[model samples]
Target: MAGSTLDESVTAFLKNHASNDAFEETDPVKASQKLFPEIAYTDTEKAELSQWLITASHVGSNTEDAAKAAERLSTLNTHLSSRTTLLGAKPSVADIALYQHLASVVSKWSAEERTGEQGYHHIVRHIDFVQNSPLFGLKLDEKVHIDADNVVFKIKPIDAKAEKERKKKEKEAAAAGAVASGATPTTLTGDQGAEGKKSKKDKVKDKAQAAGDAVASTVVGKPGAPEGAPTKKKEKKEKQPKPQKAAPVEKPLSPSLIDLRVGHILKATTHPNADSLYVSTIACGDPPGTDNTSEFEGQVVRTVCSGLNGLIPLEEMQNRKIVTVCNLKPVTMRGVKSCAMVLAASPRVAEGEDSHKGPVELVNPPADSKAGDRVYFEGWEGEPEGVLNPKKKVWETIQPGFTTTDALEVGFDVEAVPQLSGEGAEKKTGVGKLKTAAGLCSVSTLKGATVR
Candidate 1:
């Protein structure tokens, strides 16, 4: 790098930006905004980029605490697990900082460290994405070659709805604990005065106990009974339930909440009762004893029922690497419990058109992608729900944005999804291609088709 033919101005520009991490408010969205003025970043995004930039910049600090650095890396990994870029689908100066600082260290990570039980899988994923995605276009002399088969630990997909509820309960419990201890109010669950008062459950329990004590006192002290007479029995009081709280707001609709995976079809058979459905044994990267999964030909696989029996040939459906929606609630079709849905691309049907036609093609994963590999729409990447509610129609809501580019590559069009279009340039536009860590998801011959 020292002997390169770069001019003095170029060298100075690089040096100044490298030193900008030293600036807190360069922990400054203004600097990042100056770097890329086209992206109209919100205050939240600016703050995020600022903090992560500080973290990324200080990743190799000699004075930083060892545990703190490790924690920051883990947090970064978790953050990237559901995002394509640091700013959640948009590239930023912070991503560059992360790549510049940790690429060397990530390159040397063992398979266990890269994807083990407590591994930084998302960091490895970020490194790979940063170096390879056209968004960043970093030109390194040597790029880290990530092996798809070397992932030692398979992290189960997160359930967004469940996680939200868990957090909500934790918040309420903390508030309750604070109240119980007579601490100053911190979290606001509802009305401030009401929260200050004894919780309904606590008040009810205290009243019940007091009444029970009074009854027991009188029953044991009755003088009408003989001296040796047995005491009257104490009646049991039934426990009262706490008042139910209203449901939390629904999670925002996004492609990231749908768990997509690269699945290997082990075998395909015609559904016995349903002639239009094909029951398939697919290895979707589930561990042994996963619900609705059975060992088929020595592989733990899910039994998926797809209506491709008449649309696609039996041979095409057999032994193929296709994308599967892994989180939808398993449904029984024609006496067979279908565990997952196979994604396929078909021509867009007009209002009066027949939905099930012969021109359907399986959405293809990269040639090197393995079963259980995380698949996501590029910009809309994030953790998916553990089990998507069929009743809620999450898929139906997000499916309209699922489409194929002119090149036959599957993607999610952000602008087309009005529900996800927040008030900002960053969220309103972009066609994020569907891909796994390996490469783009595509169909053999289905250009400009609808992918679901």
Candidate 2:
């Protein structure tokens, strides 16, 4: 803070954003409400602003209490978790007060302190948004450099509508409390308390169903018609054994059971809720109306979420060809459901080592290949299953065999996975290079690495 943390926010705001008319007002509170925010703060929000201002004033004082500051900041962080600003997507003077007191403090924090499990992540994000975002229009020279990709813990964002509903319920409950004290609740009315009431349409539907049931009773035999006994005419036919349906012939255990394809990443953005995942729009050659796919920029695309935010540069993920496992059942990651897996290569880590700590490279299909082109381990080529069954664990069993060769080519080494090497296994021998019609799938630098 320029002088004192308490005064800096107003001083900065008055200098940067206040109009000349605001200068005529000597009182800080009135000037703030006059020039700082265009939106009207609710009574509750006004109380919040007053409370936070008192907390901000405590900073750099002999009477300062660290625990109280942490508690207040945490509550504010929770409130801001579901909102873009203190006023839910609209900037307010309370934010400026928060930033002035915490900007220098946040600048000195290590990555762990900024985004670790115990870190004040939402506060850091709030500060960054205030300074850089056009909405606030604050142009301070000394800004904190918080790395967006280095977040250690991911918090699922709270839905704004849910928060509003919760607040509404709290207000209604407060009104009910007044009702208990003999005051009439504005909520009660003739049309209210409809817990068991049916609408006219619903009653009509029920009456129609009852009439149809009465008619159906005539043809279905009277209510007391000896339950399972058939009529004389029906019993006249000879009983015949129905032919048993032939069992489905299961495909032999093979790596080909996992459908792999050459996919083109149309665009990608970091997952809003997950720190280490990328939400991508990928073209996988699916026709229009294909399951789990949506049209994007004139192409049928699947929204895939991959845990590659820090591992892969987001720019490299755009407009690139990579191998993808298409048959894996869609899994919801964070809040987004990933329809397919983006194949990448990472070095074989020791048992206790973090497998995700990478020098990772996305396994690239040949540049000329089109999206949705069939990609398979050469020696195990066959028709891939439509969707691999989770109970079968086919992918879990076969993924260990997926590896990169000494020549940087992606392949399935049969010897590495013994379960797929014998008896009922598909007749595949040695390492089979993964390829499409255009060319081989290869990683840039991670040769002899695991491909998954």
Candidate 3:
């Protein structure tokens, strides 16, 4: 019988039966007989469907294995093309099983790979037919359209009821915890009273205090003396004076937690999907020092995606030595994956003026410094984070430290020029000087610019 007719018959038979013990069968044979008691298949047809299921399971084992399985399925599909089903003319268990297997495998294949010159048209047809049949239990709205081949296929639908229940349970658990802690349970939207409100800084402080309390509990025993017994006062030890040791010198503050390196742009191109972005391949040299086992130690070609399309002309990008954040996580801009970020400084636009027309200059490296060389402030020495998580606010904290001076020295040192009161009197007090490692990344041009 046709799949629609079979579905109708199964529905009608199930509707007519109302026995509570009908689903109590536990044995595999008994369960199968109870569920599909009327549907019967020949031994040869059953064997063929079993073979197809076994073959489909091995589809993605490896390239060779997948190709072999595809070839077998293609041949089988070709043979069954003239028939409505895998066996004879009517849809059967064999047809359903084989169609399901094909559908499962097809979802994994890319649109181009699914319908190429050597594609299995018959398998695709069979999948489309089975998915549209009443027995599939899939709605038309659930089908996704593949633009490349103009084929519509059903994707796995999410269980909305289960998801809702999971979220509800989570909310209940949070509410319970809040009640236990003597705090009012607030809605997920956080529209609590002003008395319960906490700023971001306040929240961070609370978290830090909680962490400190946990650490203190681990280190020292719980508060108060052990049960009973009067507490004895301990005598303090006498202080002894010894030879004074040299005071430890304070280290300079680093401008950023980012691993800024000198890199030479090897290739630059406008991003196909975004007009404001430029995709460039940069060559950053290996890590400094010997015996380094870091994977990034050797010469690395990092793909950098930047929004300097309008600011920097395409021709000027070639062989340009630019400062790059070498340790940033790879991000996909448009369709291309970028592994690094180029550094540039642009002056802040005046209240009434546009900043785009202002001169945006790239931070220049020292003439002696080569690609891959680490850029450090004058007094600090340490490695940058391998990869910075923006969520941690590391970049946000150090961004203000990067600035230029009137003298055009492009470094991290903040210099303050004092107004002259008198010739004899001291001119000004030096303040706000940024302390960086010995080496500084600089640019010859001194126009006021903001480093990004």
Judged by lDDT against the true structure, how good is candidate 2? 0.73
TM-score of each: 0.49, 0.47, 0.37
- Alpha-carbon deviation at 410 in model 3, angstroms: 1.4
* Per-residue alpha-carbon lDDT of candidate 2 for residues 101-203, written as tens digits (9 for 90 to 100): 7777778878877778887777887787666643345557567787767778765444446667999999999998887754444335565434226566986
Q: Which candidate's TM-score is highest?
A: 1
lDDT of each model, Cα atoms only? 0.75, 0.73, 0.55
- Among residues 3 or more apart in sequence or in different chains, the pairs in candidate 2 whose N, CA or C atoms overlap within 3 Å are none
Question: What range of 10 consecutive residues in model 2 has the weakest lDDT sum?
Answer: 1-10
> Of models 2 and 3, which has the larger TM-score?
2
Q: Which candidate is the best by lDDT?
A: 1
- 1 or 3, which is superior by TM-score? 1
